[model samples]
Target chain A: GAGVSQSPRYKVAKRGQDVALRCDPISGHVSLFWYQQALGQGPEFLTYFQNEAQLDKSGLPSDRFFAERPEGSVSTLKIQRTQQEDSAVYLCASSRGATGPEQYFGPGTRLTVT
Target chain B: SQQGEEDPQALSIQEGENATMNCSYKTSINNLQWYRQNSGRGLVHLILIRSNEREKHSGRLRVTLDTSKKSSSLLITASRAADTASYFCATDGRRGSNYQLIWGAGTKLIIKP
Candidate 1:
């Protein structure tokens, strides 16, 4: 596609349920990132992937949040045992390079844990 | 926090007027970038100003960066109703992770048509 794309634009899950958000970045993008946005706050970094290497996962809130980009082009963010506090918009972005490059974001997946 | 802090959490302006938003950061940054988010969608990159550059322009958007004070400003000239959106300032630390860019709370801009 012309821009980054995310699947399941909106998802509602009960507490303790597991949910997965998918991100398909622009083809050939070398860098991918995952972020979580609360109601009115800015995006907070969750993790980052350079090609297929998961170089930065410090931003992930907890062990419940996991992300992977296996083939270097597509990524998935999985949340296990989702809590009410985990309800937020999951955003994915991709850049052409690993450092100091402009990131293109996707429409985001709004996960509501009821 | 190295993340930038944006002032005027909310802004309302009339069409054809100019809107300016300010952001301040704590530590040194390699570059500052501005992005626009409409409703529930994603953010679109507006402009980027490096630490060494004082100012830059793209269309009606003008961005100014002052590394000495660790501050930056984004000015939108002749605002239009379609320009209504939330604006954010993101900064990449000079010595942090390569892919991490801390973002501010953002300023919600409403352009009255």
Candidate 2:
């Protein structure tokens, strides 16, 4: 892909419902990251992966948030029992490596929980 | 918790004027990077400065990092209306292989044409 791509640009879910967001990172990238951005705020780190390994999940707000990069190419962020506070934009980024390389970001999926 | 904090929550300027934003961090970092985001869009990387480097330049952007003060400044020369966007400063602590990037709230810049 020319750039990172996210699916279902927008999602509306009722409280307690589950929603899944997908990200297709740039081809051949080795590092993937997920972030959550609240209105009028900067993106907050959620999780990070080096290829298929989930190296860091410390930033996940709760156990309800789960992310997986099965093939190290595409990833998915699933939130269970969504709450109103979950309404925000979920962003995905990928870098060439796990080092201090530049990261390319996807447009993100805007999730609205009501 | 956020490691970086950007000053001047918002700034309004006319086109062609230069805009400056500052960021302060709490701990030591391996590198500091700047990013820009338009409304309802993802962030775009602007520049990255390593801890060993005092300053760096890219096109109309100039970034200065002071590890002693744990601060960094970004100067955009000759700003245009298109430059109106939110700017963020992120820090890479280089703890391990994960490379976590702590972000600041950001400074919103509005350039009037």
Candidate 3:
């Protein structure tokens, strides 16, 4: 792909429903990141992956949030028992290398929990 | 918790006027970056300034970093209507830390044509 790609550009789920968002990072990129952005707010870091290794999950807000990068190229963020406050834009980004390369972002999936 | 804080939650300016935004951080940083987002979509990287560098420029974008004060500023010269977007500042802090980068709440810039 030319750039990072995310699935389900928009999703509306009822409260307590579970939802999954996917991300396809740039070809061969070694770093992947997930962020959450609420309305009228900046994106907040959710998790990070270095290749297939999930090196950082410290940013995950709670047990309801889980992210996985099985092969290091594609990742998924799953939210269980979604709440009204869970409604936000989920963003995925990738970087060329793990150290300090610039990050390229996907359009993001806007999740609306009603 | 957010590591960076940007000033001026929103700004309205006329076309062709220069727009400036500032960001401040609490901890030491390896580098700081500025990004722009339009209509709440994906963000586009504008410029990055390393701790060792005091200033950098790209096209009409100018970025400055003052490590002593843990702050940075972004200046856009001759801004246009197309430049209207939400600007945010991010920081890459100490290594071995999961929070590689912390983002600010962003400043919304509205350019009246």
Candidate 4:
């Protein structure tokens, strides 16, 4: 793709339900990142991947939050037993390198848990 | 915890006027980057300044970094209505030996035409 892309631009889940968001980064990009953004707030880092390796997952808010990039190009973020607090925009970004490079972001998925 | 803090939560100016935003951080960084996000859109990379470099320019965007003070500024010259967007600053640093970026809340810029 010309730029990073994400699936299901919007999602609405009932509290206690599970939701999955997907991201397809630019071709051959070596690094990918996931973030959660609240209304009128900046992105909050969730996790990072160098190729298929999950180098850092410290930012995941809780055990319910999980992300994986098994093939390195496409990634998925899964939230289990979603709560109303989980309502936010889920953003995915990719960079050409593993460190210190500008990242390209996707349009983002707005999740609303009711 | 977010390391970078952007000053002036919101800014409004007439078209053709220059706008500036500031960001401050608490720790050493390898580089700092500015990004712009229009309403309901994703962020686009604006410019980057390395820790060793004091300033950089790209088109109408001018970025300055003061490593000693751990602060950076982004100046947009001759702003246009299309320049209306939220601007954020991110610093590349380590969190307990893990490389990641700390982002500011962002400045909402409105260029009124």
Which CAPRI tier for candidate 4? medium
lDDT of 2 by residue, A1-114 (tens): 399999999999999999999999999999999999998888899999999999889989999999999988899999999999999999999999866468889999999999
Q: Which residue pairs in candidate 2 have backbone atoms (N, alpha carbon, C) closer than 3 angstroms, thus clashing? A: none
Predictions' DockQ, in order: 0.68, 0.64, 0.56, 0.62
Off by more than 4 A, model 1:
none
> Which ten contiguous residues of candidate 1 chain B have the minimum total lDDT?
B92-101
Q: Write the per-residue lDDT of candidate 3 for residues A1-114, one digit (tens) a residue.
A: 488999999999999999999999999999999999998888888888999888888889899999999987999999999999999999999988887446888999999999
For candidate 4 chain B, the 10 contiguous residues with the lowest summed lDDT are B92-101
Error of 4 at B66 (Å): 0.7
Q: Model 2, residue A69: displacement in angstroms?
A: 0.9
lDDT for A30 in candidate 3 is 92
Q: Which pairs clash (backbone N, Cα, C closer than 3 Å) in model 1?
A: none
Per-residue alpha-carbon lDDT of candidate 4 for residues B1-113, written as tens digits (9 for 90 to 100): 78889988999999999999999989988889999999667999899888889999999999999999989999999999999999999887565222477789999999999
Span of ten consecutive residues with least summed lDDT in model 2 chain B:
B92-101
Error of 3 at A11 (Å): 0.4
Model 3 CA deviation exceeding 4 Å by range: B94-99
Task: Give candidate 2 misplaced runs (Cα > 4 Å).
Answer: B94-98
Per prediction, fnat is 0.74, 0.63, 0.52, 0.61
Candidate 1 structure quality by residue, lDDT tens digits, A1-114 = 689999999999999999999999998899999999887788998888999999889888889989999889999999999999999999999999878458999999999999
